[model samples]
Target: MEESKAGDLFAEGVVKHYEPELKKVEKQLNELTSKQSSLLKELQKENVKFSSIDITELTSLYQMMKEYHCRLIAMKKDILAAAERSEKLKNRAMKLKEYKQNIALENAHYREAQMKREQDLIGKPGQPL
Candidate 1:
């Protein structure tokens, strides 16, 4: 019973530890999404303004678009990595919970067997159970 309680506590701790990381990743993804939206709007505006053939201005806009694309890609990768880590932690917690349940089931079976033994002893005197 104590061991099961300990396992539960450990699993809870693990879950709590991952919660902050999950929230952080979600926040970062939200921020990135907002930035991406702004960049898309900027890109659309720049494309409209590109009617004048200024090579230097076109080059600057192209570079800005590329940087925005790169950052968005990197943010997506980070989000995926964080999601994978969170899933792993959840799986670990599930396994720990299963282990504790198995222990409790085993303990219940042992207690039942002890009770049966005691009952048998009451029926039969000076007999080894």
Candidate 2:
């Protein structure tokens, strides 16, 4: 039971430690996504024609969009991995709690049975009441 409690606490700590980092990454991903959308909208407004815009400026915008896309992908992957890890830790903690509960319940049952046995012995012949 003690071990289970320790393990549960450890899992909770780990999850808590990473939770903020996970949220930060998710927030960055959302911001990046919004930026990407805005860039796309700008490009659409321009009809994406190379002849109307300076070549260098268009290329720069394209590069910036590309970089944002790459970063967004990486951040999304990071968020997914973090979420999976957090879920696993939560499951482990829950299991540990259940195990601890089972242990406590078993101990209670054992003590009850032992007390009943003592009472029976007290009523037995030649045994102290």
Q: Looking at candidate 2, what is the lDDT of residue 34? A: 100
List runs of model 2 lying over 4 Å from the truth.
Answer: 1-52, 124-129
List lDDT for all candidates, in order.
0.95, 0.94
Best by TM-score: 2
Report each candidate's C-alpha RMSD, comma-separated, in the order given.
37.3, 36.6
Clash tally, candidates in order: 0, 0
Clashes of 1: 0
Task: Give me the displacement of residue 90 in model 1, in angstroms.
Answer: 2.9
lDDT score, candidate 2, position 36? 100
Tens-digit per-residue lDDT, 28-105, candidate 2? 999999999999999887786645779899889999999999999999999999999999999999999999999999
> What is the model-wide C-alpha lDDT for candidate 2?
0.94
Q: Model 2 misses residue 58 by how many Å?
A: 0.9
- Please provide, for model 1 over 12-32, each residue's C-alpha lDDT reduced to its tens digit, 9 standing for 90 to 100: 999999999999999999999
Best by lDDT: 1
